[model samples]
Target chain A: MEFLLLTEKCIWFGLGAAGFAVLFNVPPKTLIYIAFMGAMGGFLKAILMHFDETNVIISTLCGATLIGFLSIYFAHKTHCPPPVLAIPACIPMIPGKFAYKMMIGLVNLSGNIDHDTYTQIMSETVNNGLKVVFILMSIAGGVGIPLLITRKESSKGMRLRKRS
Target chain B: MIAPSPKNKEIKDLGNVLLNVGAMLLSSGASTGRTRNTISRISDSFGYSSDLLISHRTIMLTISDKKNDYFFNNLKRSAPHGVNFKLLSGISRLSWQVVEEGLSVNQINVQLSRLAALKHYPRWFTLLFVGLAGVSFCRLSDGDALDMVTVFTATVCGLFIRQEVHKMKFNPYICIFCGAFTASLIAGGGLKYGMGFIHEQALATSVLFLIPGVPLINSFSDMIDGNLNNAIVRGLNGFIISFAIGMGLLTSMLIYRF
Candidate 1:
C-alpha cells in the first residue's frame, strides 16, 4: 500500500513537471523525461530514507548514483541534457528540509553540550552535510561520465584521422 | 560549410549567438568544474571563433575587416532607430563563431550606448525574478494569503532594488543579499497576513526560476557533440546556481523568522 501510494505521488509529481516544462516552452518530450527521472529519483531517495540504516551520506550517494545513471541513459537516448532530467529527478533527493532542520538545530544548540547531546548533534550535522555533498557528487558523476566518454572519443578520432 | 553569402553570414551569426547564450547559461549553472571545462571545449569544437570566448572576460569584441562593412551598415541603419550597435555586437558575441570572424567594434559601441539609453535589464534579472517567485510560492504553500502577497510584493521590490544597485555597479554578493533580504520581508509579510497558499504558489513557481534549463541543455548538447569538459562545467554551474538560490532563501528565512 505504501509503495503504491509512493508510486502514485511520483506520477503526480511527474505530471506536474511535464506541465511546467511545456508551460516554460521546453519540448514536451524533454519535460516528460525530466518528470519521469524526478519521480524515480524521489522514489529511490525515499527507499533509502526508509530502509537504510547506514550513514545518511552513504545511503544518499548510493541512491543518487543509481538514479543519476538511469537519468543519464535516458537523457542520452532522448538527446536532451542529463541535468534536465537529473536536476528535477534529484529534487526529491535534495536535503532542503534536512539542511533547514540542521541550520535550526545548530542555531538553537546551546553552547553547553553534554557528551551524548554533543555527539548526537555532531553526528546529525555531519550526516546531513555529507548527504548533501554526496548527492551533489552523484549528480556530477552522472553528467561527467558521458562528457568524458565523448571527449575521449572525439579527441581519439581527431588524432587517428590526422594520422591517416 | 557553405560559402559565406550575405544571408549565410546572418544565419551563421544567429547560430553563433544562440550557441553562445546557450553555452554561457549552461556553464553558469554547472555543478562541477569539469562541466564548465567541457562546455568550453565543446564550444571550441563547434568552431566558435576565439573572440567570442575571449570576450567572456572583457565585454568587448574587436571588429574584423572582413565583416566590417556589413556590421557598420547594419549599425547605421539600426542606429537611426535608437538601437545601439555595441550592445548588439556584445550580444552577437554570445557565439564564438561570430566573434572569430570579426564584427564592427564602433557599431557595437554605438549599440551599447543605445542599449544603455534604453535601460534594458540583463537577462539574468528575468531569471532571478522568476526564481524568487517560485521560492515565495513554495513558502506561501503553508496556507497564508497575506503572506503570499507580501512575498510577491517583496520579491518585486527586491528585484527592482537589485536592478538599481546593479546599475550602480554594486557588488554581486551585495546584490544577492539585497534580493534575498527583500524576498524575506515579503515572505514575512505573507506569513503575517495569513496567505499561506500564495506563499506556496510563489515557492512552487520560483523553483522553475532556478531550473538550470540552459546549462542542462548545453550539457546535453556538449555531451552529444563529444565535448565532455564543456558539458561537465555547465552541469556544475547549474548546481551552484541552484545551491546559491537555496542558500539565499534559507538565509532570508533565518533572518526573518517566517
Candidate 2:
C-alpha cells in the first residue's frame, strides 16, 4: 500500500511537470526526459519526508537541486539550453495550495470578524504565505547551485566537448 | 576608436543577425548567461566578439573584430517576454552550427526563419494536458475522483479563455487574471454546493495553472548569476502576474462568498 501510494504521487507530479512542459511548448522529444526527472524529484522528496521526517522546505530544495544538476546533463545530451528543461521541471513543486490558502485568508481578514478570530486568521495566513515565499526562495537557491558550480567551467567546455 | 574602424557589408549584416538572435533569446525567456553566451558563440564564429547589453525588453549588440579593426552595432527591442523554449533550443543548436558548419550570415538567417516557422503542439493539445495537470494538482491535494473532474473542466475552460484573450493582445497580466478568474469561478461551484470531499481544494488548486512558474524560476536563476538588474525585472514581472492571479481568485471568492 505504501509503495502504491508513493508510485501514484510520483506519477502525478511527473504528469503535472509534463503538462507544464507542453504549455511551454518544449520540443516533444524532451517531454519524457523532463517527466522522468520530475518523477525522480518527487520520489526523492517523498523519501526524505516519509523516512527521515525532514521538512518540506529542505526536501524541496534537495529535489530542485537534483533536478538542476540533471537538467545540465540532460541539456547537453539533448542539445537544449538548461533553462529550457530546468524551469518547467520545477513547476510541479510550487506550493499552490499554500499560496491559495494564504490569499483566501487575507481576503477573509478584510471582512467582519472578532479580534481573536482576526488574530488567529492573520497568523495562519502569515504562516502559509511565508511557506510560499521560502519554498520559492529555496527553489531559486536550489536550482542556482548547479549553475554556480558547473557554469564557470562547463559553459565553454561543455559546448566544445559536445561539438567535438 | 570604433568609428575609425572601416565598415563592410558582411559586418553590418552580421551585426543585424546577431542582434536578432540576441533579441529572440532574451524575449523567449532565456536566462541572461545563456543569452550572453549564445551571442558570444555566434559572433565568435563570424570572427567578431559581441558585447551585449540586455534588458528586460531590449538587447543592444556591438560586434568588433580585433584583428580587422571593424565593428558594427545595433539595438533591437522586442515584444514582452514569452516562454518559448523552442526558440531558445533552436538558437542554441543554430549557434553550434555556425561554429561547426561554418555557415554564413545569410544561411543562418534562412535557418532562423525556418526555426520560427516550427509549429508548437496544437492548442487543443496544450489545453488537454494542462487540464490533466490541474487534475493531478487536485489529486496531489487529496481531492477525490469527482473533484478531479471539476478541476479538469475548470482548467481547460480557463486556459482556453486565457489563450483567446492573449491572442487578442490583452496585457499578459490581464490574460492571467482572466484565466485565474475563470478557473476559480468554475471550481467555486463546488465550494458553493459543498460537493467535493475538500471543496475548497478544488477552488484553490484550480488557479494553480496561472502561477507564473517559469518566470519565477528564471528570475531566481538569473539572480544567482550576478545579473541583478534583469533578475530584478524578471522577478517583478513574476510577482505582478501572481498579484493578478490573487486578484482574480479574490474576485471569485467574493462572488461566491466561499
Candidate 3:
C-alpha cells in the first residue's frame, strides 16, 4: 500500500513536471528529462520522510545536494534548464507545511503575546525559517557551481575563437 | 550622397560575414559578447542604415543593396503615422527597433542598453499563467467534484485582477499572495465539501505555477552560450522565486489552518 501510494505520488509529480514543461514550451525530449528528475527527487523526499531524523537542517541539506547533483547532470546531458529539472525534483524536499505552520504560530502569537508562548513560537519559527534557508542555499550552491563552470568554459572558448 | 570608399566597402563585407556568422552562432546556442562584437563590427563596416541593420525582431542584415530599401520600407510602414523614417537614423532607429521587437538579445541589445529597463510582462500571459495555476490546483486536490465552479471563478478573477493590477507596477509579492490565497480557498473549500481526490490532485497541478522550468532551461542555454554572469543571475533568480513560492504557500496554509 505504501509502495502504491509512493508510485502514485511519483506519477502525479511527473505529470506535473511534464505539464509545466509543455506550458513553458520546452521540447518533448527535455520534458521527459524533467519528469525523470522530478520523480527521483520525489523518491528521495519519500525516503527522507521515513527516517527518524530530528535535525531538519541536515536532512534537508543532504536531500537538496543529491537533487542538485542529479539536476545538474540531467541539465548538462539534455541541454535543458537546471531549474526546470531541479525545481520539480526539489519540490518534495521543500518545507512547505513547516513554513506554513510557522506562519500560523506567528499569527497566533501576535493575537496574544504572553511571554512563554511567544518565545516558544518565535523560536520555532525562526529555527524552521533558518533551516529552509540552509536547504535552499545548499541546493543553490550545488546547482550553481556546475552552471558557473560550464559558462566559464564556454566563455573561454569564445575568447579563443575570437583570438584565432 | 557620395559612393562609399573601397576600403569602407571591404570593411562592410567583413562586417556582413561576421554578423551573419554571429547570428548563426547565436541561433545555434552561442551566447557571448564576442558574437555581439562580431555583429557590431559588421554593422560598422557599412555606413549605418536605419532599416537594414536593426529592427524590433533582430539585428538583421541586408546582404545586397536591393534588400536595404525593403528593410527600411518595412520599418517605415510599421512606425507610427507621423514619424518620418528619414529623421530617425543611427542609434535612434536601432533603439526604436528594440522596443518594437521586445527586449531580445542580438537584435535589441543596443536598444535594450539604452532604455530605462523597466520589466515588461503581458497581462494576458500573466492571466493565462495564473489561470492555469488555479486550474491545476483544483485538479490536483484529490476530490470528486473537481471544483469546476471554483476553478472558473478563480480563472476569471485572476484574469480581472491581473489586468487591473498590471499597470500598477507592483512587485511579484502581490502575485504570490494572490496565488496562495486563491489556492487555499479553493483547496479548503474543496476539501471541506468532501470533494475527494480534487484536493490531492490539485496539489501537484497548483504547484506547477511555481515551477522554475523556464529559468532552468535558460540557465543551461546561457551556460552553453558562454554567458556565465547571465546564467548565474538567471539561475539564482529562479532559485529565489521557487523558494518564495514554497514559503508563501506554506505561510498561507498555516494562517487559515485548513
For DockQ, the strongest prediction is 2
Scanning candidate 3 chain B in windows of ten residues, the lowest lDDT window is B80-89
Please report how far candidate 3 places residue B55 from its true position, in Å.
24
- The per-prediction i-RMS, to one decimal, reads 10.2, 1.3, 11.7
lDDT of 1 by residue, B204-250 (tens): 23223334444554455555555576567656755665555556666
Candidate 2 lDDT? 0.86
Error of 1 at A66 (Å): 5.0
**Candidate 3 Cα deviation (angstroms), residue A146:** 3.6
Report the C-alpha lDDT of model 2 over B1-258, residue by residue, as the tens digit.
Answer: 233323577889899988888888878878888888888888887778778898888888888888756778788997678888888899988998888889988999999999888888998899999999899888888888888998999999999999999999988899999999999998997778854454677887898988888778778878878899989988999999999999998898889876
Candidate 2 has a DockQ of 0.79
By lDDT, the best candidate is 2
Q: Give the runs in model 2 whose Cα sits over 4 Å from its true position.
A: A52-54, A159-164, B1-7, B194-198
Candidate 1 residue A1 C-alpha distance from true site, Å: 2.5
TM-score on alpha carbons, each prediction: 0.49, 0.95, 0.51
What DockQ do the predictions score, one after another? 0.08, 0.79, 0.05
Alpha-carbon DockQ of candidate 3:
0.05
- Report the CAPRI category for model 3: incorrect
TM-score between candidate 2 and the true structure:
0.95
